[model samples]
Target: MTMDTAIARPELLLVADAVAREKQIDREEVLEAMEQAIQKAGRAKYGHEKDIRATIDRKTGDVRLSRWTEAVETVENEETQIPIHIARKFKPDIEVGGHLVDPLPPIDFGRIAAQTAKQVIVQRVREYERKRQYDEYKDRVGEIITGVVKRTEYGNLMVDLGRSEALLRRDETIPRENLHNGDRVRAFIYDVREEPRGPQIFLSRTHPGFLAKLFAQEVPEIYEGIIEIKAVARDPGSRAKMAVISRDSSIDPVGACVGMRGSRVQAVVAELQGEKIDIIPWSPNPATFVVNALAPAEVSKVVLDEEAGKVEVVVPDTQLSLAIGRRGQNVRLASQLTRWDIDILTEAEESERRQEEFRRRSGLFVEALDVDDVIAGLLVTEGFEGVEDLAATPVEELAAIEGFDEGIAAELQRRAEVALERKATELEDKRRALGVADDLAGLEGLSPAMLVALGEKGVKTLDDLADLASDELIEIVGADAMDEDAANAIIMAARAHWFEGEEDAG
Candidate 1:
């Protein structure tokens, strides 16, 4: 429509209504945009320094343009403000903060003015649309959305989500899954970001959440919350593992997810481009859950190191390849699903390792306590890990061992204490040789062995220890030596002198 027709005719409101409907924005916003466009043109017709404003009659579509000059005690600019004495001539009751408004006749728009107005309206509408898109989709993150592929740029898919467009980056798409323009696709809304250019909606097909959402859509029990998907891990387009639990005991989680003849799972697999899925039962027990995660392979034994957050799984030799999968894919996905680091070993390998450990610990007891092989083997078999364990054991408890008498237990304890003292003395000598400070040795949590370890790492003084972070201290010593809290305590103790000096200075 021409600018004159747009401003003067009743068709302006109709055009605004149509634009609002088409752009999916509020009708009032379109009217405001039109008002801004008119205001821009009004300033061009009048002086640019004048305070011009424009408003549309929402009901009649009539446009009003006016210059607003504030009634001030003293005029700052002749173009935009008037003195109260002069303003009183136009409005007898005008207040100091009130405006003296003068209505202006509509201007005949030239080609350039019309283009500038159009540009303003277009820019305003785009900004509103972007804001609306951001507000609508920001809360929809982690939801499954379907859209048609609008175009591709640099291997990234620009998807048209009806009212808004979303981006599916190349890495987010399943490997080798080809999508073309105008093709319909489903993806998970991973993020919605407000960027300088516009609101960015990021989509992903390979996200583990995508797989979980797909399963929720396909599985009736999961949708109704009878069965909950605990975790999901994906090697997109190749394989995935989902751990599920059922609140209703009668309904089997794995069997329900699989469906009759695998219909339910097949639907999700089809959407994922034939990625094989293993639906495993979830358990509260970490060992049980880990065993369930490694499906199609029997776990002979599981040794968990809770402090280390690692699990060693012993499987029969025949099940090793299956448990590990091709190129470790099965175990890798299992690890992701369980949130644990897994070390897999064959039955024979685990047996050999256990035997070797038994020999080593037996030899340690034999040498440290000056005991015979039989006695050392008994000590190792009874779970005495070190000379410290022997020294710390009560005489009554030590005598309670099958082969031990009270006299033998007492002698063993004395010998254990002597061995620990000798080890400490050796470590103290090493610590002194490495120049670790005496005050550092006085720290409560640190043993002489740890002091030597710190000295070897060049943390030889209170200042050096104070400067070390807890993680660095843990690393310098050993994870088994102390945990984060103990490390922090020692570091704080090392820093005590600094506070004392500050107090003295004060």
Candidate 2:
């Protein structure tokens, strides 16, 4: 058929005027559809997010198109083609090996899908516009936004973020923070994405930074840089600790955050529904910093291990229990803020930890414990099956064995001492590390056989008993068969090692 026949028959467009009569959409949109349809039929395929332009006659709804290319010497394929002579018509200067794109319209556009494709092209354009909007917002994730609560659906809150709806997940809600219809809520937009529905923006109030940003919004000193938030830790809806500092000596960071008569903080607290806010002054000195972090608790001394990033906080015997907190929460948060391992204890426990460190760092472990790793090699020649069996034989008895020499025997004795001490120390240290408090005294009172039995059960040190309360001791030692006082006596005896022996002697 000729080009005129194809134009009269039309493609999926049905008729040039059908757009004005039926789809009720602007005539421009229908023209865009026809242009896109003709462009797609010329290529005979749908192209994705690409930059191919098309022009449709506003009057006839017929279209033409082209893609950008440079004039090239060798034409690998045929889509965008230009003879070297004809290419100079568009460009005054053109090269043979360069690129060129020549405009072309389908001679028989109606030969492709006629009416059906016109409808599909319009739908594709609508879908593309939706995606365009989504792409514009997807990169704007993790921004704080103000949005009205449009409504709640399937437990997910849909917020109208002006041009888009952002999803506020159920878990991200500040605990007990409710929303009313049309209530304008301020939230941190945690994420944005493209989905079938549209742009998906995830908001969060439980996020700790949300509190910091909220304060920044409400406090001018912070926004303007007179005051800055150094650290923020939060248990949303319950309490938060924020450390602030001031660049200007005249401005008090804490006072600025707290505002006059607690007014500034009260506004944030009210937004959080009476959640407590502690505005602390930031400190450069780590020990001072930590004492501040463990607020409400009196710290006697703060010993920090700089290389290992560990802190040992010594409190008075009276404050030890409180400094450590319920389930050790106070020290735990302090550890997170300071980015260090924190050991919280009474003054007495601090002294013992130092003593334990001395024992572990002593030369006994270096030369002495070196023998443990290769004990298997020595045993192969000497006929001992395992470490415990070799240990059961005294140093002198092992010295008498065929392959053993005096120096090797002596080294073995030292290894045993360090190994046994370390094993006991580790058992004790593990308990202390678990946020359990123990007495500074050692364990004793148990009979020698019972002591040996306890070693077999891995209760090698007094700290082990400290980690376990009286009930745990009973549970392990089988109080089932023992009389009540006997079980209680055994428990007391187990803890007697670290204490000094009684004054009177036989």
Q: Candidate 1, which segments miss by more than 4 Å at Cα?
A: 1-7, 72-79, 83-89
Q: What is the C-alpha RMSD of each candidate to the true structure, in Å?
A: 3.2, 18.6
Task: Count clashing pairs, candidate 1.
Answer: 0
Give the Å shift of residue 187 in candidate 1. Answer: 1.8
Question: What does the lDDT come to for candidate 1?
Answer: 0.93
> Could you say which candidate leads in lDDT?
1
lDDT of each: 0.93, 0.67
lDDT of 2 by residue, 203-307 (tens): 988777788888998899998988888888777787677888999999888888888988889999988878788777889998898898888789899788896
lDDT of 1 by residue, 336-413 (tens): 999999999999999999999999999999888888999999998999889999999999999999989999999999
Query: For model 1, what is the error of residue 315's alpha carbon versus the real structure, in angstroms, after optimal superposition?
Result: 0.5
